[model samples]
Target: MIEVIRSALPTRCLYSHVVVSGQTIGAVTRIRYDGPGVMVPRVFGSVFFYQPSQKINLCYGEITESATVNQFAEVIAEDLDALRDLGSGVWADTVVNPVRHVVEVGIQEW
Candidate 1:
């Protein structure tokens, strides 16, 4: 299952982790930026970790201006905690099982 949270900022950075069954399953950190005009959204960088004990996967993308790298790092830590909680719960219906490039979110012209 995949759970996603959208940011209200035009330039927002986020990090999260996924844990399953009381174990740390995965971790993700990303930064996303949205510029004015026709410019494409930018993803700064990301790092992820996937543990085999849990079937959950982690992903990160696009760094944002609102958070310094250090601040974002802190956010990432917090997200990991939240993800772990979410993953351990019975959230099969709250998460999404995504397809490849054929499917996506927040896109108008996919």
Candidate 2:
């Protein structure tokens, strides 16, 4: 089963790294990103932008390394920047680790 490794920074990123991608998803959605890199803690982690609905809300990420993080004014600027970078920038900086074993039930929006 896919699980989140759990860490302070990643736990913080879940709530702090909120982005309005203006991308609307279907009733069922699975955002995915993968390649030869170490941005996220998993092969399937939050590597792109997402606009949150009232339905599902939770993310867990721990930063083992970062570049854009240090560039912003706020410490979370790292998370913010990393979350918005989409493909490469985020892949280069952050690590993708979600909450532990919640996918069994899954999250949904009404």
Candidate 3:
């Protein structure tokens, strides 16, 4: 499993590691984030996962900034119409604390 924590400073670049576990041998499948306010944190980033033999893409997306605190953000390959072509069995869970200006992400593989 992969875990990451990042500062939420404006204009700064942040990244988290995507962890995988279980029968599946791939990269991140989905991403979920939460913050103090009702709105999701505004962060721009992407995640990539690869198999043992060859490098491949599993799932990725861009997160826009939030104007309010009531919004939450999540990106699932199966949920997105454009990402249906991507693989399955892996996903990410994240939390953003606006007050603390930090983000935490957890990746799981099934």
Best by TM-score: 1
lDDT score for candidate 3 against the true structure: 0.28
Output the lDDT of residue 53, model 2: 27
Model 3 residue 104 CA deviation in Å:
1.1
Q: Residue 40 lDDT in model 2?
A: 27
**Taking the tens digit of each residue's C-alpha lDDT, what string does model 2 give over 1-110?**
01211111122222222333222111123323222223222211233222232112222234332322101011133354433333233233333443322112222211
lDDT of 3 at 42: 28
Q: What's the lDDT for residue 1 in model 2?
A: 7
**Steric clash pairs (candidate 2):** 10-61, 10-62, 39-94, 39-95, 40-95, 40-96, 41-95, 41-96, 69-78
TM-scores for every predicted model: 0.20, 0.16, 0.18
lDDT of each: 0.26, 0.25, 0.28
**Each model's Cα RMSD:** 14.2, 16.1, 16.4
State which candidate has the highest lDDT. Answer: 3
Clash pairs (backbone) in predicted model 1: 2-96, 31-62, 31-63, 32-62, 43-62, 44-62, 44-63
Per candidate, the number of residue pairs that clash is 7, 9, 11
Residue 38 displacement in candidate 2 (angstroms): 34
lDDT of 1 by residue, 25-106 (tens): 2322242232222222222222222222211122232232332111121125435555445434323322344222221112
> Which scores higher on TM-score, 1 or 2?
1
